[model samples]
Target: MSQPSSRPELTPRFCFNQTALRDFLRLSRSTIDDSITQNLNALLTPSTTAFNPTSTSTRSVTPPSSSRAIPAQTCTSFKHNVLFPSWASRSDVLDYCAGVATSPDPDDPDSVLRQIEDEKVRERVVDERLDPYSGRYFPREARTESLAMLMRNERMVEKVVRARTGSVVGERCGEGGGLEGEFDEWRRAQGSGRR
Candidate 1:
């Protein structure tokens, strides 16, 4: 087709024009980067699923029954988990013990952990506040945050029992001390699962 020869033929031809090629390459790079990041995160994340897999929605699932109050060592302690152990920030420690989360820096909450100079102090924060691990019954509990709250409450109750010389379901010292240490004794009880 030889119509008007006004156009020059020196221009390089490409399936995608320069602007289109730039956009396409950028999109491709972003997609590849996202896929790689997701794969890496998958490797780090735990592979466990919820106990109730058949449920259509999370809201529909029933919650587990409340656990018996556990010992302070088996739960969170304000001195170890919340503040500096050496009574450095006494006021902040007081508030933290009363369930108030006080960040080291008013502007940035993350500075709370960053401000700790001692390795032991930082380790406590990491082991308790940052990642308060569940112990024996961790397998049954799926939600970490929920487990953390339960631990906190259990500790609080245990503290009260210690301070006031009270009794709790787990620490039933008021009922002539706790469970009798006889093998198959719990099985004899009507309510116990072993029965």
Candidate 2:
């Protein structure tokens, strides 16, 4: 049996071709549209609509009296109860919450201790794994390049849509009555504007 070499193998970095990326984005328009529709439906659909008491009940309901103000401790507890579970997935957030709950800092008027705790939580959560530019997480360069290409594709799609709808200016402006004429017109406009 041959032993494997101990040396680490270096792989070539893959760079995206702009044209191919644009084409891919154009082809994935339907998927993007479906996602947008799904997200919109999710946002529009009320979570509590089915359990709405007013819709089911025929009896007249009197609003509760607010003569007595809610206790500060009760209000704080209620707020914590509603909010803490949302951060349950994150350990850093849970640690911050636990620290805040345990430490009752009344001496510091500016709440510097709480701010420091918050900063610590932020630092813990925003490690190298969360870094967008770090190649350690992925073998790619900056995400901004992908974003720029996507934006360019979106602009191209928009231009195509406008041309199809006859909404684009000088859509039939060229001698050939196409994009060439529009380019010629744009060049002439630019030349005239320089003077």
Candidate 3:
């Protein structure tokens, strides 16, 4: 008979399937919840000082300075140990929601929440203009009109500035006909011509 093979047969390693992953996640969540509850309870309760067997003194030992006395009412919310959703547990999200709900400047037109709400309403109104494929809603016609209005306001301001200053600061020669044209005319009158 041939000698027995020196190398051992290879065996497949165990891998976590979807069910195993889910079960593990559930167990971990339960463990974390239990730990949090225990920690909170420990914080609320008064801790006893450890006995020093080596010392002969009869006086009671005091608790360490690190142990703080948590107020009873503060621990009430954590007493039930109900697990909140991830977003609800976040302090910033809670603060923002609270701020929006109890906004001091509710009547102010420039309030951030009011602005966001107005934008949301506008988006809803123009929902028909949304592109299904791209998932983008661009009211191009409205945007163009708004841009034109802004440019017109800018040109009007430029005209007023030209009239007040009598000299263009950074205005292009071809665009505004006020200061540029007048300056060119003055140069021609002086026999220097356009530079």
Candidate 4:
């Protein structure tokens, strides 16, 4: 056998798909229905009105689908509780931010500090959970992501911001309005923390 090189060649890896998993575990529609019935009896109730066994008048309750057709407000609440725990409620967040915005001077050091804390809270909420199943925010904080993918996404965000603002450096382009001073203060505060 030839001597192995200092750096071994990387080989691609394969993961089993869901269909393969189901086949391996012998999962079928009947099994899935049974599991669902066991798991969601409170949510899915069958009509229990008694009739003659010979009569076909027995009614059944249909289970809600995974689509979760609940209202947007309900979904937002679920996201707040399950996906975001940093800021309490959306209204509270908005009020706090508005209070900071309407301050005598947004560029004030104290107000900048408060805004930085608020942004840090928001960042924690977003980064803590990433749901792969629904391709939405996942509540499991321990789950990790690839560094390369994270870098790519960060670069993409920088590109989008540049495209929107039309400036990678220099003073605000007039459209940013008076908020520019507040933004600069916030960025300075963030940068100072690292040093």
Candidate 5:
């Protein structure tokens, strides 16, 4: 047998597509339906109602003629929970957002979302969930996003001030303008620890 090479072979690694994971991170906790959350840890978690085969035969030369089943319905407990594409018709999504919108301020990070009276802006927010199943955001998403504005706005203000005034500002003596609370969660997710 030939001697083994000193260097290991370079090989590509594969991972699951990020479509679902993107939604998991981007989606506000409110958007996760209660029905799904209730059974999330169980062996057979509750799922939105869908029809037809969800998996496709990748071995085929061409795309499968049939499409994956789309969820037909979602949780009924919360008006803000939208898990399926078909769940948010009749302008319910827009209406829900409008109803929940708080007073907008220029310094608020969520001012952009709160100020979305234009149809184009609203459409973009609704369509960008990136989940194949839902691709939508409900009122709860708007609320959760708005709550995070305090920290986001602070960063933006500092950036703008530094650019125009040529001076740093908004110092809080080591306080991160509320970002400290997220540190633990972020670090945990990143899996960094003392070794």
Candidate 6:
């Protein structure tokens, strides 16, 4: 019998399919609801893997040192689990409607219940969008940010500022800090050279 080749053959390079990649990342198509919200970085960030856990890649990522706690009432809307009068239990509402709908000739029970359930699901989805930390589905276009997009933009700004100024002393850049200075310098230099 002929002997097999000692070296393994390499495969040709292939392009990444972003749609497939997002699906693999557990981000569904429904996640892109609004134009302002769905930017590139949101698709690439691995959800539920905030920090690297591998032994070789372990690194310390400290939380903010401030001890202040965010107030719970800061959230705009409150949903009480037990106290919400509008919260109808499926059985109670269904049983009540059962008598009204199927009786003689009034209405259809299943259609009404289905419509209510659909509305409830939509309401829950909207509520989920309000809670960014929940990891519940928020379509990209619906909000101005996904956690990853915000992180990526912050990093990019930091890198550019660091590159231009070579200064790491200041806190996060303010609105009209070195960034505006750098831009003005560039415009001046360009104008001077044009003459």
Best by TM-score: 2
- Predicted candidate 4 versus true structure: per-residue lDDT over 157-183, tens digit per residue: 433432332221111212323323534
Order candidates by TM-score, high to low: 2, 3, 6, 1, 4, 5
Tell me which residue pairs clash in candidate 3. Answer: none
Give per-model TM-scores. 0.16, 0.22, 0.18, 0.16, 0.15, 0.18
- Count of backbone clashes for each model? 0, 1, 0, 1, 0, 8
lDDT of 5 by residue, 1-195 (tens): 011112212111100122332232224222322223232222122455664364454444653322221122211112122222212221132233233334332344454655563445456634345665554444424433443343244335433432321111012111123322332354354355433
When summed lDDT is taken over every stretch of 10 residues in candidate 6, the lowest stretch is 7-16
TM-score of 2: 0.22
Please list all clashing residue pairs in model 5, or write none if there are none: none
Query: Which residue pairs collide in model 2, if any?
Result: 174-181
Error of 4 at 11 (Å): 29
- Local accuracy by lDDT, each model: 0.29, 0.35, 0.35, 0.31, 0.29, 0.29
lDDT of 1 by residue, 122-151 (tens): 354233454556211212222223333533
Residue pairs in clash, model 1: none
- Return the lDDT, model 5, position 181: 30
lDDT per residue, candidate 3, 1-195, as tens digits? 011112112111101122332233334333433244344444444535675676656664666422443453543233223222211222222233233334333233335554575587566633345655444444333222333443344345434533533222112111233334544443355455333
**Stronger candidate by lDDT (4 vs 6):** 4
CA error at residue 12 for candidate 6, angstroms: 30
Q: What C-alpha lDDT does candidate 3 achieve relative to the native structure?
A: 0.35
lDDT for residue 105 in candidate 5, whole number 0-100: 28
